[model samples]
Target chain A: MKILVCIKQVPDLESRFKIAASGTWYAAEDLAWRLNEYDEYAVEEAVRLREASGEGELVVLSLGPERAGEAIRKALAMGADRGVHLLDPLSHDKDPRQIAGAIAEYARGEKFDVIFTGLQSQDRGSAQVGLLLAGLLALPAVTTIVAFSHEAGLVTVRRELEGGARAVVKVRLPALFTCQLGLNTPRYPTLPNIMKAKKKEVRTIAVTDLPQVAALVRTEKLAFPDKRGAGVVLEGATSEVADRLIAILKEKTTVLK
Target chain B: MKVLLVGEYRDGKILPSTYETVAFARKLGAAAALFLVADPSDLPRFAGKLYLAAAQQCGEYNPEGHLALLLQAVQAEEPDFIVFLHSAYGWDLAPRLALALDLPQISEVVALAEGAFVVPACNGKLRRTLRPLGQRAVLTLQSGAFNADGEPAGTPQVAPLTWAGSAVVELVGYEAASRGAVDLSRAEIIVSAGRGIGKPENLALIEGLATVLGGEVGASRPVVDAGWAPHERQVGSTGQTVAPKLYIACGISGAVQHLAGMKKSGFVVAINTDGDAPIGEVADVLVVADLKQFVPLLTGKLGGV
Candidate 1:
């Protein structure tokens, strides 16, 4: 009952973002890096499954520059048995397919019984890698999973759909599920675990070891999203704000007007 | 240019997002065809030809079977561009299809201009104009970013196709969230609450306002994730895309994902304590006040009026 979880390091969403001089990506020098929110659930789920079964080697895999090792170590502190870091210096701008292909290259040899990933990376927001990796691996793939249960080499997951519809699916072993929020609350790593994680070795694999794939999408330029318009701000006390809002709704907009 | 628009349908109804994607494909002024993966019943006369891949497995919306079916169709009917709605299904399928076909793929496109695409990155704080460097490109159009009124006036051709693939997964059942029969997408007026509402009990003020305004209650993702509201009442990229006539957002600081769902509303009113909240930029009426204090006042005043 071996399980693999794919995690990525991302900048904290609350941080102020600055466009790089290249006008293509955000400047990373001053940003605070943390584990991606969705992948936190993925790692938590993997750790819980391992704890429940009381058997199985839980491997946390991440692909990025050296900074991503921090995220891998966090997963280790969260109770993963080992970590595999696919190290690549020029990995930031690669598209999802290329990233998934590199992962498949490494994953094909390991043959874990099940794989888990975040529904989408916070940075790309393409929601592509998990499904693409599943496709490349030719395994059963489910996305936006909120609830999961496992027994007897069979896994059942509840997936979140558009319009808030939910579907329960069952898949055989050697499957892949991309987790969404509300699946489980991630636990903070204790000081002892953090010390233990620091001692744990993370095996590094160079991206050059894998087949090179070119990016499909080319970014020409990046700019701030155009502001819609100047909104009339109602200030002062609570009553005044409420009064102004209601007055505008009744006088300017169609609501109540 | 030849465009292959992959259409999605569910529960015996064609998704309106497909029409919006078609509307975008029409902007390319290409010879477009919609490849539908559903029962070919009541097929709307789209602006272009329609091809149906009514495979049994595809009926339930599994990505594996749909990918294989669409791959088969793409090989047979090669097009310069492949378009899909950037909905739940599209986000899952486009990358794999592009990889298998060795084509370029872009997601969540808001605009197409002069062979370049406008897409959001860095959590929608920045927009990037991208170009496909491949011979053919697969794209997913952002929902509500395009016009839905571009279906041609004349009848289009319908061609039946077959898919030969196996589903690696099986759908056991579906459980619709209990949302008190409130479909936020169809609601004309929506009063949505955010985390600023503080607690689950504080939702009564929001509901009270909606009740008096004769509208439905929607919520931000945090509120829904916290169990203050059902997922069905959530409005966001992962929840529901809505274009209500009037949207009153209470305490929502405006995460880009949440704004993606309601930015198209006819009118927007935002209430939050922070004047610098991103919601202030998009809202037509910005009330910079604490939602806990402001909601009750607004509800009470509206009630008396």
Candidate 2:
């Protein structure tokens, strides 16, 4: 069995973000960057899939600037057989669907039983990639998958839905699953794997080689957002505070009951 | 030109939100039709043809599988545009469908206009008009993006068809939830407390504000992890999906996870002492003063008291 995992390099979750002077996005300078937290789950799931079956190869893929290779290395360290980096320096403002196209184009030539991605990226939170990639690949797409297993060309997965609901589904081969965090605790890189990943073949490819640019949407500009102030807390008991808060909310708008 | 609208139903009943989508579809074109991918008897009414899928539950709605179905469906109808509610099912499938069909897709659009649609882009920094590349475009309308168009449109003719036996997916089991549940998607207002509020006991103060707003209270992941709020009340990737009219984030640092759930509110007000907090960046109206000092002052000035 062959598996492919999509990963992203994002700012560490704990970074302090301040919007640029323009009201579009945050300033990236001097901020610490790292692997997307949820994507870590994707890499872990792929690794586990290979280990459980004991015969599959997991190739990890990441797209971003040159710095993105740092993220692919982490997945390689975690034991993926190989890594691919698609260069895109102007990813910040491009359409996510366009990026999805680039990924689909590269993987179109290869055959993989399954593809995995995080449910959503930590930075954008658009939650569109895995599904969009599935569409582009003309394959099945599953979101918020918390668990998975393989049996006779069929894939079984557990999906988390709204209101604490859960569903177990069985899908055929060549499917897409977007992972939720906490689905599995990712393993740390072992000393042997760490050293071995350094020798693993790391492939570098350009965006132009893929079929993504022709369909890509151009971005004009990305600005930072507006600023906000602090809030006030009401004094007294819950009842009094509830009453007082309700009154204040009512005064501001007509939503009051 | 006619538009194709997808109607969703579950457990032999139509969703209240699907009707809103139907209404939105009707105004978009004269020959609009909703492909009711379930039992026809379960729905309220439709203004156009209700095309039923062979299986009962839209065959578990895998984006690629559904796109395959949609590609065939669109070829038959020749719809000028396709629209749907941006539900979990839609989110997973819509953009993929757009890419599959090689048509640009726009999401989180509260309103539609001629050729181009008005959508909130990049955390609501600005609302931009998005135009698709093809003549026939696909779109996922924001949940509750528009109010109901009108009464049950004239009973649409139900057109049922057999499934192609190619969905390649099966729903093994589902854990049903209780009714009268707090669905954040339809909530009109929400009050959320974050790390700045301190302590679970302080939630009462936050709940006070929720009671006034006639809405539910929410919390950031840290607050929920800290047991200050139930996991159900948490907003973000791991929590509920809420698009209330007015959303107040009290003392929250505004992580992306938290924003994912509620950033689409009609009006967002953030109360944080830190001028550089992430919440402050996207909030339409911001109060930079201390949450503790101002929360009561605003509550005290309320007239209903």
Candidate 3:
């Protein structure tokens, strides 16, 4: 009944982002960091599964810079038994293959029954690592699962599809799942739990110590997307704004006319 | 370079994105072939070779089974690249095929640059150009990014492949989304709400505006996930891709997923407190105001229509 959950630290969605000087990624300084929203749901689901089983160990893992350890600690506070941090200063530069290869290298020997990860990270948004890790390990995998149930070593999951459709899939243990939004409500760490989590052991492994995998994809440049057009902005009193909007809709588009 | 396009077959028909993938391959100006894992019934008239695998052995949408068939196709065709639509099927299968073949993989490519691929990141605020270092790669094109127009008019050579692998996962069934009554795709006008609406009760303001405008109500993923709106009314990558005549987004800070659904609307309007919201990038009109006061006033003004 052992379970492993992979989490990532990303810039808070509300943070104002600035392009770095290199023009390959966002600036690292003056940014607030938090656990990726989707990964939080994965941690909550793993915590609930371990609690229901009443005996199994729940391990949390993260592959990112030093700040990612904070995300692991948050998961620990939420209810994981331990944490594993694959520390890399330049993790943001690594592509999905390199990231998944590092995780696969660490988890190869650990025979966990199930592995969980967010459907995608908020920053990269590639949505490739979990399935890539599963492929590297030769384990069956499902993505964007919103509903999950387990019994007798068989796991059934309802994965989200386009247009709000759900596909039910069943796979045996030694599998992987990418948790999506609306999967569950994550719990906030209370004071006592936060204090207790301070004692939890978090093993650190330098990503350099792991087998190096060459990045297949490289970022050539990063920039703000081109604006579609110069949009007319309306402001002032609500009544005046409403009047202007109506006039524009009638003149600019056919829907109102 | 040679290319392979994987077509997604679901619920007895091929998806439109399959042809869109063809449009992508044609953009590369390379020899291409199409692959599908289904019974040979009225196949598409691809200009290149078409590879078909029986659904009985592949089990229609099983990752391992499809991977096995695709692997065989790759061995035979020796394509330099494989392409798929960024649909649920492609999102699930492309990475598996990449890792199994030990090739680099890129997902959700929105545009093709001179020699790189452009992808949206950070909720569509940023775009990154990615170049593959490997000679071969797997790519999933963003849906609707490529248009299938003026398709080839000739039939393709059919090549049947066999799958001998065992299934690793079972396809149990599918649960239809609740409240299928609202079809936003057919609506001429859509008035959508987002988290800025504040609470479930605030949905009334959105509905009132929609009614006054003679349009259907739409919602962002957050609004739907919060249970403020039904799944059918959700508009986004995972919800619905719509191209209405007029799309008025009230309080919706457009996430990339949400923008993907409605970016094709003829005219876009966004009302949000933050003028810099991503929705403003695609909007024709940006109204910077609190939705609480603005929506009611707008609805009252439009009531005479």
Which stretches of candidate 1 lie above 4 Å from their native place?
Answer: A190-192, A233-247, A254-257, B150-154, B181-190, B196-217, B237-246, B255-257, B264-266, B272-281, B287-305
Per-residue lDDT value at B233 in model 1:
89
Candidate 1 lDDT over A1-257, as tens digits, reads: 88999999999765677788888888888899999989999999999998988887999999999999999999999999999999987777787878998999999988888899998888777788898888788787888899999999989999887766778888898899999888987889999999999988789999998899778777788777776666788875477677777777777667683
Q: Which residue pairs clash in candidate 1? A: none
TM-score of 3: 0.95
Clash count per candidate: 0, 24, 0
> Per-residue CA lDDT of candidate 1, range B1-305, in tens?
89889877766667777777677866788888888877665675575577777735465667777777787778777899899888767777787788788787888898876788998776666678888996689899887788777454555587777666566778777887656666788988999999889989999989998998999999999898878998778898768889998999998878767988899898898988766566876899888777777777888988888
Residue-level lDDT tens digits of model 2 in B90-208? 66667766776677666655666576676554334334455666577777776655668566756767665554455466777776532335566777888889888877777887788
- What would the per-residue lDDT of candidate 3 be over residues B49-147, giving only the tens digit for each residue? 988998766786688888888998999999988998887899898998888888878788989898789998887778899999978889998888888
What would the C-alpha RMSD of candidate 3 be, to one decimal place?
2.0
Model 2, A75-161: lDDT tens per residue? 999979999998887666556787787898888888888999998777665577787788678777778887788887788888776
Tens digits of lDDT, candidate 3, A97-144? 999999999999998888999999988888999998898887889999
Best by DockQ: 3
iRMSD computed for candidate 1 = 3.2
Per-model CA lDDT versus the true structure? 0.83, 0.71, 0.88
